[model samples]
Target: MEIGLNHYLVLSTLLFAIGLIGVMRRKNLLLLFFATEILLNSVNIAFAAISHYYGDLTGQLFVFFVIAIAASEVAVGLGLLIVWHKRHGNIDLDHMSTMRG
Candidate 1:
């Protein structure tokens, strides 16, 4: 009747799986970024759960760093998405190759 590490792990695994599927199936650049964020959040959950289970702060610390990085990634990624959308008038992944150098 109580939550445990296994519960967190299962949830994390499910989230990661969903994110992976989204990344694979989504053709929009914004959707891909969303999937990546989901994947990052799943990892954060696992790290925090394991850290709590082991009575250690390292996992929690790592989670903080991950959050910071994820935030910055969202900023840069959204900026790029906006630029791409402006230039192309669309955000399809299939047409991204047109930006190649």
Candidate 2:
């Protein structure tokens, strides 16, 4: 059987759910960033699938923008993560409560 839009949608939904769970359960900054990327990728997959089904380029174009944004986000986020890790020696959410202004 050929894969259809519904199959793509279901897959995307599952991916997004897993990412959401990770974001909620993870305490590490790096893992949170990874989860966010997974969420973004799921959206990209849905967009591409819908665009293909509808014979339109808008969704695909949106996916491109999403990828660009995700890339920039990763760059900035990782840089911040490094700085935070260097200052505190740990990137755990619970440990962050001890930070002072």
Candidate 3:
């Protein structure tokens, strides 16, 4: 059977769901960042598949921008995680409650 747009969308939905669950259940800063990345990647896959199906470049272009944003997010988020880990000795989300400004 030929793969179609529906297949890609289903996969994307599954990845997004997994990411959402990870975000909700994970307490470690690093793990949370990974979950967020999964979410971004899922959207990128959907965008690419739709672009290909419609014979348009816009969705593909958006995917490129999303990738760029995800890369920046990873850089900033990992930097923050590293610093937080060093300062607190752990990257638990619960521990961040004391960081209120």
Estimate TM-scores for all models: 0.92, 0.93, 0.92
Ten contiguous residues minimizing lDDT sum, candidate 3: 92-101
Model 2 alpha-carbon miss at residue 92, Å: 0.5
Model 1 per-residue lDDT tens digits across residues 1-101: 99999999999999999999999999998889999999999999999999999999999999999999999999998998888788879999888776572
Expressed as tens digits, the lDDT of each residue in 23-72 for candidate 3 is 99999888898999999999999999999999999999999999899899
TM-score winner among the candidates? Answer: 2
Clashing pairs in 3: none
Report lDDT (CA) for all predictions: 0.94, 0.94, 0.92
Q: What's the C-alpha lDDT at position 33 in model 3?
A: 88
| Consecutive 10-residue window with the lowest summed lDDT within model 2 | 92-101
Window of ten residues with lowest summed lDDT in model 1: 92-101
Per-residue error for 68 in candidate 1, Å, reads: 0.4
Question: In candidate 3, which residue ranges exceed 4 Å CA deviation?
Answer: none
lDDT accuracy of residue 5 in candidate 3:
99
